[model samples]
Target: MLNPFSIEGEWFKGNLHLHTTGSDGKVTPQEAITSYAAHGYDFLAITDHRQVTEIDGLDHKGMLMIPGIEMDGGQTDLNGSYHMVAMGAKGPMSYDSGWSAQELIDYGNENAEFVFIAHPYWLSLTLADMIDLEGYIGLEVYNTTCHYGVGRGDSGPHWDDLLARGKRLYGFGVDDAHFGYADAWVGYTMVKAEKCEYDDIIAAMKAGNFYASNGPTISNLQCDGNKMLVECSPCWEIRVVCPLPGRGTTTYRSGHKPPFTEVEFEIREGTDPIRIECIDEVGNKAWSNPMWLSE
Candidate 1:
């Protein structure tokens, strides 16, 4: 089956997880919006902890503002606290620490355009803690705050484990920017949408027409039958990951004098859902959304 990248659209860079002075962030909502807009971000979500900071009246200039919130949920002791980011939320969301993971996920699914688990690796969350939760769109594969603080980011393995179990969760990379100890503009999602409008962007996100990146960018990705082709910014390695035993991953190193900007590989049968990762010499990486063979 062909990958979602074949869809035609304009790619817009956006950060879906952020905090402001409404909570514990160092900057106010206006400052956060202005900074992101000046930095050329197409869209941003000001997801304060437990409270959805209303941005409807704020002048975002040309940048699209998405209503969002971050909440703590699930069994605190067993799961180590489940943090969730809800984008395109309708109204203010109150914090309810007593809700189970599933409960919070369902609520978000019903109320928001998209919902994703945040900083799973930094929280030391296990597969068992998340595998059973339904309605969540995905997990943060890379959280810049987590990486900068405790060096625990990149939940690709955890996401792979869920994919292996037949879960169809997308992956997101975010800064989780608090603008105090954590910085912004480090990680983001490139969403392929019909336009830069709010509805279009939300639609693309819900459809998984996006890729997560810390630095490198994926220009193209195509899958035809058992063959796959990928193109990205010049990188030292391109890896194809399959969630199957014994045939887990294949890496293609760019030994060329100038490095490689593209690579192709043959897909193996039973590798139903496959994803790609491109890593540069400096260790910066980009991730493609998983492609399902049946799609």
Candidate 2:
């Protein structure tokens, strides 16, 4: 059987964070999906803060709505501002002052569910505690609402450092939708699954079989335990870098536009660990941490 990480020529694009009238947004659940689906989105997780968008008659009805919620955490005033994502999950998971944010994260992870450190570099929540949490599955590198909210240079450093440690951390980009005002479809996930379906997409996400982006689109990407292969449209260059252990490194670059001319590189065993990056014409970058085969 084919697995989630196995690329079979299928790609999924959708937003994970969004808000409806249930929270702070203006539109209702139906209107939110209506607008996004028309924009060519394949999937969407309607994450109303502290409130899960109830799909009374709309479960898997029109567009693909992956059930999810944004659990608010952190201290009262300090650096306690944090947001966490519970994807393909149903809850009862609400934000409360009595329970710490980290505790909610633990609950999600312990249940074998998908949890992403929402906008690690945004708002009052930095990449502080998320680094220490072993149960964390992924981190949001680009959050639409907070992309320009706080500033740039939020997730790049943290992701780099984690990659340096040879940790197979996955990166995700989300709209963190508070409504139409935040550009709900701003961020999307690229899956390496066989085709488009609910279970397949969810499985891909859980297996780290995808990459996150705000604008760029990835057509095909593959790695076969040695050389890495990538094909994308509407881009300029392909940059492949492996974040080796001990602060070491390895990198490969190829200049090929659409039609995706080929770019090949070698990775030696004792030459530090590795990762791959895709750089667009405007200098925008999509990165993937090295998938280590050895210690």
Q: Which numbered prediction scores highest in TM-score against the true structure?
A: 1
* Candidate 1 local distance difference test against the native: 0.85
Please, what are the lDDT tens digits per residue for candidate 1 over residues 1-295?
4255788778999999998998999998999999999888999999999989989778896899999999897774454789999889877676577988888887887778878999888888888888778888888998888888788878898898898898988889899899987479988999998898999999888888899989999999988878788899998788888776755354443344435687777777877788899888898889888888776
lDDT of 2 by residue, 71-154 (tens): 776653354656778887754555564566677777666542588777766644434555556666777777777764545423
TM value for model 2:
0.81
Question: Which regions of candidate 1 fall more than 4 Å away from where they truly are?
Answer: 76-79, 253-258
Cα deviation at 276, candidate 2, in Å, is 2.5
RMSD of 1: 1.8
Highest lDDT: give the candidate number: 1
